[model samples]
Target: MRLLTVLYDRGAAQLIRAWRRSLHFRVVSVTLVSSTLLVVTFSWLLASQITAAQVGSRLTEAQKQLEQGRSYLEPQFRDRGDAADPGLNGFLRYATALLVPADPTAYYVLLEPTNKDFLKAVKPQSPQIEDTRAAQDAVPADLRQTIEHSRKSAYQYVRADPDGRGERPFIVVGTTVNSAMGQYSLFYLYPLDEQVDSASSVRTTVFVAGLALVLLLALLSALITHLVVGPVRIAARTAQRLSAGLLDQRMEVRGEDDLAALATSFNQMAANLQRQINRLEEMSRLQRRFTSDVSHELRTPLTTVRMAADMLFANREDFDPLAARSAELLQAELDRFEDLLTDLLEISRYDAGFAVLDTEAVDLVPIVNRVVERLRPLADRANVELRTVVPDEPVIAEVDPRRIERVLRNLVGNAVEHGEARPVVVTLADGDGAAAVTVRDHGIGLNTGEDKLVFNRFWRADPSRARQTGGTGLGLSISLEDARLHGGWLEAWGAPQLGAQFRLTVPLRAGDRLLSSPLPLVPEDAEPRLGPIPPDEPSRGVRHAS
Candidate 1:
């Protein structure tokens, strides 16, 4: 039973593997089935011929023996004209002695009409000199009458001793003889058992030959199928490698068949794909350089205008109320424009694969404190309280302090804008191989399921919200990009009427990895636990505040 189970498992595994890796199974199955049908057809024809020939030979042999039996009995009756009892017995003994050795299982019986009275029939057994009345109905009446009518010779096949206890099969050949007492019938019985044995042996031989032929055909079919499907297997493997980003993969084109043409086509396709990729890469580099140049060019003029505006605003008391207000608005607008340019430039750099990280061991606690201090004035004006939580020891990380500081300041400012006069919390902590800073605000935080979209460019949870402080909506987007450049995590968690949480997790050392964030981004006061965020929402990007 265990072996049977193992066989079943092996068969199932083989089928699965063949389905996955081999195309020859289908080919082999079709070939074997066809071969099996042909072999069966041929075997059946041969079996029919063999059976026919055996039966014909048996019939021919039976005819020859019947002719010989009649010839031998003709002379015996002619010499014994009207002779009676014991002389006929002597004649029968002589005939039996002549036919015994070649086929010992032959029998002869002689019957006199009416037993010298010609009124009643008599029968005799072996070694009995006088005729007896036993076995009078041993033969069928039709056959007995035919024997009586054949005063010359007749032959028939019948059951031996039909009315006796056991019925055996034999051929009966008969002739009638006239004697001194009356006319008598002489019959000989020959067994047909040898012919049956010959027929059975012929069938057995044919069956064995058929089995061998079928097995041979199956083996040949398998080999042929394997050869035909081998190239297809190679092509499938090459296609798989090409999909896995191996642009140089090529198939061996050895023949002039369709498979070889397919291989040639695959190689050409790979070459074309590689060329397109290279062209796109070159175009991307040129675009990045153009964006950077424009950003630099704009920065110089914007800086000059900013310094001039500050100088003009310093003496604003002499100007009219309209002019003074105009000056302040110009400065604010210029600041927002500059922030947008900077983010666009950074994004171009990232797209061109030019962004690089400058790593150093710096404590995150001081960074968070500085960001909170910078945003404290804005928080107070907005009637929002700002709180900071820092660990005792230095929660050190390898990061660009300048970029990291800019990111924290953006998160804090964003919280203050939406805090709705509620307290905002900035928490920092150390974790295994990483450090995290979370900024939380108890405000009408965001639209339902818009936490991830908060970091996308120019995204707004509320479009009607005023940008009084002059913010370019690219701060969180740029921050997220910066965090990704350092292989860190910058994610948000928020809900409607609850609060918003933005967590920035950075590695402790250069190239250090993070399994998970130490602080959770989603606030505790959200209504639903988790919900799907729509990607096509109107407020689906970063909101950068300058």
Candidate 2:
């Protein structure tokens, strides 16, 4: 039963797939089925009408012949006068010989009363019919009863199989004949072989014609479908070509029809899209040029300002306290400014497509550990606990160590800044062909819908809040670009007050596609709980562990 069910389901699926793939097949199949049904229904109606007409005509003819036989035999009986009583046997035999058709296509039977008590012990005689018993039995009992009970002429259709011959249709007509002798039942059987043959011929003709018509309709339907679907197929191909960067491809317009108009519109759309793309390309080229030129122009002045600020900050103890503090502030601001300019330069290099990776097989565990150790001082000041979960085995991958270190630094720093004095977990794991790192901060967390925006340049979860570390806001964006360079993935997930998790997944070898991340974006220990933090909560911090 299971195997049968599987076979049935497989068959059904194949049929459905076939039905969807070919419009021509669908159309042809439907047309053939509908035409066959119509042809069969019409043939059945025509055959029924023909059979009824043939039977009606044969019944009428049989009734007339029966009446004629009765008339001829009755007259003979009447002419015998008083001699009819004793001469009934002679009359019956004579009538039988006279009335039975010599053509062999018809037969007759004459039945007379067996008892002759009214003739003073004279035995009534009946004419012998060849195969009389078989013929009598062939007639339906209901039809015989109908004739026996009524003097009115009656007829019925029956199949006659004489002498073991195959059954053939026949019409049986019966009536009572009155004479000086007792009444007799006269029956004439007429063979309908000719009518049956004609009907068979009609059926064969109808079947052949219906089949031919169905075939013709199928051919016509296929031709029509081809004419309509040809243009659609061409349009689909041309569209595919356009999508594949063949901007100059266009459909040929042949006539002033809807299909031609559609082709015209499609070509126009392609032309318009090509123009817009060209314009956008020109604009992007100009923008990148302007950014590169501006960054280069500002570098000279920025270097001079940085030198002056450093000199003042170094000699600040010689000045008043307020002057010293101002000089320190100036140095810090200049440092932040320099960092922002450096980030902008890096972004410009990425936009100009000049960034290149110096890849090497490096263990990511030390890199992650070094980044966390470097940020331990900052984490302590922020009162945020930092935890590391690195596998003992080296997680080796082909990556640019500098870029990977920068990415990790940015992610860990961002988590510490937003940790809200809560614990932050940095995890690293290795898979079969990939390695991943996750930085999860159980901080004030992120608001709904801000997870993806966190990767955008300069995007902040809370713009009103100032950064303790003075982030340049290009960190995550540059990190994403760096991951993409290695054909890796950088993804973020967050919930309200449940902290945010940033995941970086890379292939074991540079340029290889990473199918999955070894580490989950969401921490396993995090639960869905909501409450307000108490003001008296102590600031907790943890030291880094390798």
Candidate 3:
């Protein structure tokens, strides 16, 4: 029973989902439901109108027949003398025999005088009804009261035995026939069984026809939607393939209709996009090649320049003050230039997809400490304090130690370079099969939205402000690539003047995906309104080049 319940629930859920998602299903279902309601309303109105018309027609004919029988019968009552006359009962019986129709479903009733109580002693006041002994009981009291006083005829519907033993509905129309002898009420009991049967059959026919009409409307709606939705579905699929690098995907055009025109326009847009993408690809390829060639070509000259600069520095004490100063400046500039070349070569390798990871199980604490310790001199020169908040337990992970060290150096170096003489904190944490490192600096922090822009190659916050360490501006971009290569995340968070935090999270096992990081991207001491980034969504700060 429990399994059946679960199966029913699953099926219902799938049906509900399909109802919400499918345009064709929704359109057809709505049309069917609305059409059914309309058909029901119209069928009810039609059936009701038909029933009323039949009753009206029957009533008019019965009234006409009553008039025809009364025209000649009133004269006989005039010649029969006053209410005290003898043989009046016989006269009534004779009048009934003449007036009653040949139809078996019909009958007649005649009642005695309303006044002249003295005549009641001569004859009984009991009504005279034709054909049946108990037919007098069928005339309702309310109907008799109206007919007794009025000259014009009136009708009332009642269920009564007209022919005795069998009960059915009837329309009793009664009128007054006046003469010198007395007043008389003549009533005709008309059985409505035939009209009832006719109305019932009509309702049934209308209902069946309405049902058929609803089905036909639904079918037409489905067919129309199919013609429109079919091409739209095909266009959607073609667009998907085009986005997935199938540059030649195009829509098929048929006759010169609106749909064909739409297909032609779509094909033109796809072609234009393909051409633009091809042009961009070619330009990107040429740029990468140029960088690689330039970096390689400069190495030999850079080496020769390095050797000469080193020799000049060694012998600089014997030269004049100006000469010694120039030699020192040249050596410093040469070092900065070489670093720039190295960064460019690294970027070119990354762009060409030549960079690789060499992984092994190693403790990350040592790597963090090494990066911090190596950059301590730079921190001190910048008047910035360096701090580490690593756990006593070794955070072991499968990673390329060299690549991790490089990423750490880039993060820590940036912190110290811009720490504004404040403390730069490096916290290493591990949990949930992942290891994370956050480098935070209370410095001239990044401006709003600069957290993402900082990772772009050659991007600088204040480009005119001279860099003390002569940065090549490619560190963060390379770090982002390295993190992604390990199925990990490199993220950043910042608010203007508050501080900036850079988080690097990698899986403990090689090639494993990182679901979450051990440390938050937003620092604890930052602005209260700067909420921590959700671990599930890809942070905008990590959207650098692949």
Best by TM-score: 3
Which residue pairs collide, candidate 3? Answer: none
Query: Model 1: per-residue lDDT, tens digit, 1-546?
Result: 999999999999998888666557765666667777876777678767775676456445544554565566556656766554567667766764443213445455556566522212222233332432223333445666876765556666666553233565566665665545557665555555565566567667766777787777777877877666767677778778877878678888888877778778878987898788778878887877888889889888988998999887777778899998888888777778887897888887777777888778888888899889988999889999999989989887889998899889888999899898999999998777878888889888667558657776788888898864566788888888888877788877666677778888888887876776676555444424545444553222232221
Predictions: Cα RMSD each: 10.7, 7.3, 4.6
lDDT of 3 at 410: 93
User: Number of the top candidate by lDDT?
Assistant: 3
The local distance difference test score of each candidate is 0.71, 0.79, 0.83
Q: Candidate 3, residues 236-330: lDDT per residue as tens digits?
A: 99999998999999999999999999999999999999999999999999999999999999999999999999999999999999999999999
Error of 1 at 154 (Å): 32
Candidate 3, which segments miss by more than 4 Å at Cα? 1-12, 65-85, 101-104, 113-153, 158-161, 164-168, 175-186, 527-546
Preferred candidate (lDDT higher): 2 or 3: 3
Evaluate residue 333 in candidate 2 and report its C-alpha lDDT on the 0 to 100 scale: 87
Winner on lDDT between 1 and 2 is 2
Candidate 1 ranges beyond 4 A from true positions: 1-283, 527-546
Off by over 4 Å in 2: 1-18, 63-84, 96-104, 113-134, 145-157, 163-165, 173-186, 321-326, 352-354, 527-546
